[model samples]
Target: MTLDPPSTVSTTSRRGTATAATRVLGVLTIVMIGWLGVFGLLLSPADRDQGDAVRIMYVHVPSVWLAYLAFIVTALASAVHLFGKSHSMQADRVAGASAEIGVVFMAVTLVTGMLWGRITWGVYWQWDARLTTTALLFISYIGYLAVRGLEGSRSQRARRSAIVGLLAVLEVPLVHWSVRLWRSLHQEATVLGTDLDVSLDGLMLFSLFVGVVAFTLLFLWLLLHRSRVLTMIDLSAETGLDAALAQRRAEGGVTA
Candidate 1:
C-alpha cells in the first residue's frame, strides 16, 4: 500500500467546497460580466447628461464596491485571527487572500474613475477629498501586503499582519464619506446614498446592479483560489523546515 506523505494529504472537505464554489463562480462571472458588457456598452441607452461616457459606471461602480467589500472581509478575518487562539492561521490566510484581491480591485477602481473623470470633470487627476483618501487607502493596503513578506516567526507575523489589516480598514469609511463630508466633483452613490441621490432608471440601473453582483462573485472566486494556493505554499514550507531540522538532528547522532 502506498502511503501519502503528511504534506501531500488528500484535500479536506472545506477545500473541496472552495474548489466547487470557484468553478460555479467562474461560470457565473463570465456570463454575468459578459451580459453586463453588452448591455452596458451597446443595449443601454446613453445618458442624456454624459452620453457614452456614462457607460463607464457599470465597470467603475462595481469595482469600487468590491474593493470596499474585500477590505471588510480582510478586517473581519483579521479580527478573528487576533481573537481565535486555535484557528488563527486559517483566519490569517483568508485575510491575506481577500486583501490581495482588494488591492487589485482598488486599482481598477482608480483607473476607471480616472477615465470617467476625464470626461465628466475635465481632468484625469484631482486632489479632491475623496480622490485623495482613496489614493491613501490604496497605498496603505499595498503596505499591508508588503509587511506580510517580512521575515518573522509565524505567531509574530500573524499578529502583525492581523493588526495591520484591521488598521487599514479604518480608511474605508473616510473614503466613502469624503465627498459627503466636503465639496468634491465625484458624484455620490446612485444605488446607495442619502444626501446625494442620482436618478438611474430602466436598463442603466439594471446593468449597474448586475455588474456589482458579477464582480462580487468574481471576488469570491479569486479569494478562494488565492487562499488555497497560500495554504499549499505554507504546507510545503513547513514540510521543508521539518526535513531540514530532522537532517540536522540525525547528523548529530540523534534519532532520524
Candidate 2:
C-alpha cells in the first residue's frame, strides 16, 4: 500500500522555518564575506617569505574547509537515508546538493593550490601525497554523482548512492592525514595545530575565520534552496500520478 503524504500543516511549518533560516544565514554570509574580503585583501600584512602571493591562502584555505564541510554533510545525509528509511528522499536530495557544492569548492581549492604552487615551488602541478590524495577524493565523489544520476527509482537509487557516499568518506581522512603520513611540500594544519607560527598573526587568523563562517553560511543557503527544489519536484510527480489515475478511472466509468 502507498503511504499517505505528510500533513500539510507540518510540511508548511517546516518549509517556513527552512525559508527563514535560509534568509538569516544568507544575510550573515554576505556580511561575513564582505568583512573577510576587506581584511584579507586590504588589511592583512604581506607574508615575509612568500611576499604578496601569500595572500592566496585567504581564499585557498577557506575553500578547502568549505569543501570538507560539504562532504561531511553529504556523508551524514547518506547515513540517514541508509539507516532511517524515513525521509530517504530528503536525505538523498541533501546529499546531492552537498556533493554538487563540494565539487565546486574542491575545484577552487585545486586551482588556488596550483597557483600558489607555481609561485612557490615553480610548478603548476605536483604529485605530492597531500595534493594527489585530495584530487583523488574529489574525483571519487564526482563518480558518485554520475552513478546517482543514472539510477531510475528514488528508493533504489538512494540506497546505491548512499553506499557510494559512505565509502567515499574514507578519502576525507586520507586526504587530511596525507601530509603527516608522508614527506610532502604541502604545509601542515595551520589554525588547529600546536606549531602556532606567529606569521599568520591575530588579524590574519581572524580574517580567515570570518571567511570560513561566510562560506559555511553560503553552503547552508544553497542546501536549503536545493532541498526545496527537490521537494517541489517530488510533489509535482505525485500530482501527475494522481491526475493520471483519476483520468483512467473516469474512462473506465464512461465505458461501464
Candidate 3:
C-alpha cells in the first residue's frame, strides 16, 4: 500500500516564511520609518495653529490613509475570490490578512486622533460625525475578521467572509465623507481636499509625504508576511486533517 508522509514531517522541511523579497522590504521599511521620524520630529515646522501637537499628523494622516488603502485591497481581493473563475483561496487569505492590517492601522489612527484631540479639542472623546463614522468603520472590519474565524471548510469560510468583506468596505467612503456631510469637529482634508491649493510649508509637505510612503511600505511588508503565514497555517491544518483521517482508517482496518 502507498502511504502519504506525515504532515508534520512534510512541513518540517519548510524552515520559515521569509524570502529575499520580504527581507528587502523589511530593511526598506526600517530605513523609511527612520527617515519619517527625522522629518516629522525635527525637519518640519509646527503648525501655526495646532503647535507641536501637529506633529501627530505625521502618524495620524498616514495611518488613516493606510487603513483606507488596506480595506480597499481587502475588498478587491474578496471580489476576486468570490467571482473569479478560479475561486482562489489565496485571494481569501489576502483579504483576511489585509483586513487584519487595516484594523491595526485604523486603531492607530483613532489613538493618534484622540491624542491630537486631547491637545486641541480639550477632550479625548467626541460624538463628532467624522469620528463616529470612523469608529463604526473600525468596528465593522473587526466583525469581518470575526466572521472569518467562524467554523467551516476553507471554501465555506472564504465564501461567507468574502461577502462580509465586500459589505464592510462600504463604510470606508461614508467615513471619509462624513466630515463634509456634517458639521464635524474633525478637520477636513488638507492635501486631499478638492482644492488645488496646498498651503502647507514645503518641509511640512515633505514630512507628510515621507510618512505616507513609509506607512505604505510598512503595510506592504506586513501584508506579504501575513498572507504567507496564513498560507502556511492552512497547509498545516489541511495536512493535519489528512493525517488524522488516514490514522482513523488504519485503526478501523486493524479493528476489523
Candidate 4:
C-alpha cells in the first residue's frame, strides 16, 4: 500500500501545535539572552587590561559550551542508532539534528575566537594547539554530516555516519586540554581546570553562566525542530521511492 504524505492542513496543524508549545519557551529564551547581553555589555566591569574587548566572552564562551554539548549529544545518538537492538531511525534523526547544530555553533566558536584573538593576541589566527584542534574538530563533524548525503541504503548511511561521529568526539577532550597540553594564547579552562585560580569576576562569571543556560535552552528548542524535520524528510524520500517502484511493477505487469 502506498502511504501518501500528510495533507497540507494536517501538516500545518502539527506545526502550529509545535509553535504554540515552543512560544513561551522562545520568549523566555529571548528575554534571558537580551538581559545577559545588556548585563555583559553595560553593567559588567571591564578587565583591567583588555577593557571593553572582554565583552566577547559572554558570547564566545557560551558558543564553545553549546558546541561541545551538541557534539556530545550527537555522539550519544549515533551510539544508540548503531548498537541498539532496534537500530531505530529515531536515533539517526537525533544524531543528524545534533550534528547540524554542533557544526553551526562550532563555526561561531571559530569566528568569535578569531575576533577575540585579534583583541587579546593581536592576530585573528595563530598556530596555537587549542585553535588547531578546535578547527579540526569542526571539520571532522562537517565530514560526519557529509557522509549522510552519500548514496546508500538507510542502514548503510547510518552505519558510516555512526562510526564517523564516534571518532570525531575524541577531539573534544583534546581541544579542552590543548591549553594545558601546550602554551597557547587561549586561556585554560575556568570550570574544568584543576586550579580554581580563575580570572573572571563575579558579574562576568554570572553573565557567562546566564549565557550557557540561555544557549542550552535554545539548543533544545532548535534540536526538537531539526529532528522532526529530518524525520519528515526521510519519510518523504522513502515514500517517493516506494511509489516509483510500485508504478514500475504495475507497468511491467501490464506489458506482460
Clashing pairs in 1: none
Residues 1-256 of candidate 4 have per-residue lDDT tens digits of 1112223424335542245446666878898899888888988889999998988988898988999999999899899989999987788888988999999999999998899889988999988899999999999999999998889999899988988988899899999999999998788898678786766799988888888899998887778777767777786688788888888989888532
- The deviation in Å at residue 141 for candidate 4 is 0.7
Model 2 ranges with Cα > 4 A deviation: 1-18, 85-87, 194-199, 247-256
For candidate 3, give the lDDT.
Answer: 0.89
Model 3, position 188, has a per-residue lDDT of 82
**lDDT agreement of model 2 with the native:** 0.81
RMSD each, Å: 4.5, 4.7, 4.8, 4.0
lDDT of 4: 0.84
Best candidate, lDDT: 3
Q: Measured by TM-score, how close is model 3 to the native structure?
A: 0.93
Q: Candidate 1 has what TM-score?
A: 0.90
Which candidate tops TM-score? 3
Each candidate's number of clashing pairs is 0, 0, 0, 0
Model 4: worst 10 consecutive residues (lDDT sum): 1-10
Alpha-carbon deviation at 180 in model 1, angstroms: 0.7
Q: Which digits, one per residue and each the tens of the lDDT, describe model 2 over residues 144-256? A: 89978874887888888888988998899889878888898898878755465544677778878888888888887777776666666677788788888888989888532
Give all TM-scores, in the order shown.
Answer: 0.90, 0.86, 0.93, 0.90
Q: Residue by residue across 122-214, what tens digits does model 3's lDDT show?
A: 999899999999999999999999999999888999999999999989998889888878999988878877675787889999999999999
Candidate 1 per-residue lDDT, tens place, 30-72, comes to 9998999888898889999899999999999999999999999
Query: How does each model score on lDDT?
Result: 0.85, 0.81, 0.89, 0.84
Give me the displacement of residue 224 in model 4, in angstroms.
0.5
